[model samples]
Target: MAKVIVLNKEDFEKLSEDVSPEYPFLKDNREIMSASPGGLFRCLMVRAEGEKENMLIAQRKDTLYLGYGRDYRSFDLQGVPVEHIALEEPKAYQEHAVFYHRPSHISDLNGQNPLRPVPERQTCFQVEQVVVLSDEQFRQFQENGLKDDQIFLFDYSDKMWFDPGSFCWHCVLVKGENSRDGILVDAEGYSYARYAAFAPDCDKLRLQDVPVHYEYPARAPEQKKTRKRKEPER
Candidate 1:
């Protein structure tokens, strides 16, 4: 396993917009990042060990990304070494829906032996629980404006091999960071749920020539946007 590399803002910009082949950890698998409970961040590599597979850690500013693999693809992560936090808990205790982390660093919550968390590599805390909301509450949350459940929030943590079908993503979009273009990433269970995927931007990554609309999650199916005619203009 290689140590995480953190770069200053000025230094990061000097690197290539695309994946670098020079570094040992910048893999370019096109698979999008996962948002499921256990894998809240695939490229994030933030969870406890044994939780991630074939991934490397890198940081720019305050954001952490999983960008590693023996082989390179279309994109990946690269950087220099820095002291960062890595979670060592074998497991998180779950009660009902919330998952509680018992890191040894926190004496008050000590019972099981867990590794102490490092500071700017960022703190390690487990947050997994279903957010609840009544129909009215959900409506209020949407009152601000029209929104799409299938939104692509990219931040350049591209991993081409991650499959979202095994998880909770019904749809995944691998949009390029430099181009502002998009690619729809799908799997067997891709229509799994009405969810979102936060993928990284690849410099020369492939893009979808045609627009794709994942229509499974119906958008206001019962409502008609057309207005009824006024009795043929009276």
Candidate 2:
């Protein structure tokens, strides 16, 4: 349930008005220009309206790719769609149409008649599920870890552990001696091991592929103050 604020050519021009030199407005042939409401991320959905087919954009951290629909579907449909780019990477818009091209219900509603105080929308890279490796399969996974481009979850249920904020371990296998290990890579591609034997601070693995439910950590309630009677009004 997300809506986009479509920016026409004339509206797109305004992006350059106060942008820093580091991030510049797009001037290329991309036809659709739109972004998540707050504009922290910009998504370009289609080519200049003449391309034979729509291109798919997927982001692996800061890197963006211009891919085809079929190729992504072939990968068990696990392709991470680049629905938008952080405003910091203005160059991302120039490379490809990174956003999905469909208008949502709210967008249609807005088209019918504009609304004040538009609703907020969220965009991010998503994976439907992560496959947990079997013992034998995990051994094989470690053997050709980096070679396998599929995403996976490691079994860390023994520790009763989960990411402090996320449900899944959400990692990629790496070349290593231990079959139980998985490496966590940050947005910038820096890698680290999440295995308890290796990095204790690292988050424990998830036994299954599931959505991470995010809830604010509980805090102690503030004690209300009571005023004593003013000593019989002094």
Best by TM-score: 2
Error of 1 at 150 (Å): 7.0
My TM-score estimates for the predictions, one after another, are: 0.16, 0.17
List the candidate 1 regions with Cα displacement exceeding 4 Å. Answer: 1-171, 174-196, 200-234
Model 1, range 143-219, lDDT digits (tens) per residue? Answer: 32112222221211221123335422222332221223222232222221122221222222222232322222322
Error of 1 at 180 (Å): 3.2
Clash pairs (backbone) in predicted model 2: none
Candidate 2, residues 44-81: lDDT per residue as tens digits?
33222222333333233334333333222233323323
Q: Judged by lDDT against the true structure, how good is candidate 1?
A: 0.28
The window of 10 residues in a row where model 2 has the poorest summed lDDT is 93-102
Q: lDDT per prediction?
A: 0.28, 0.29
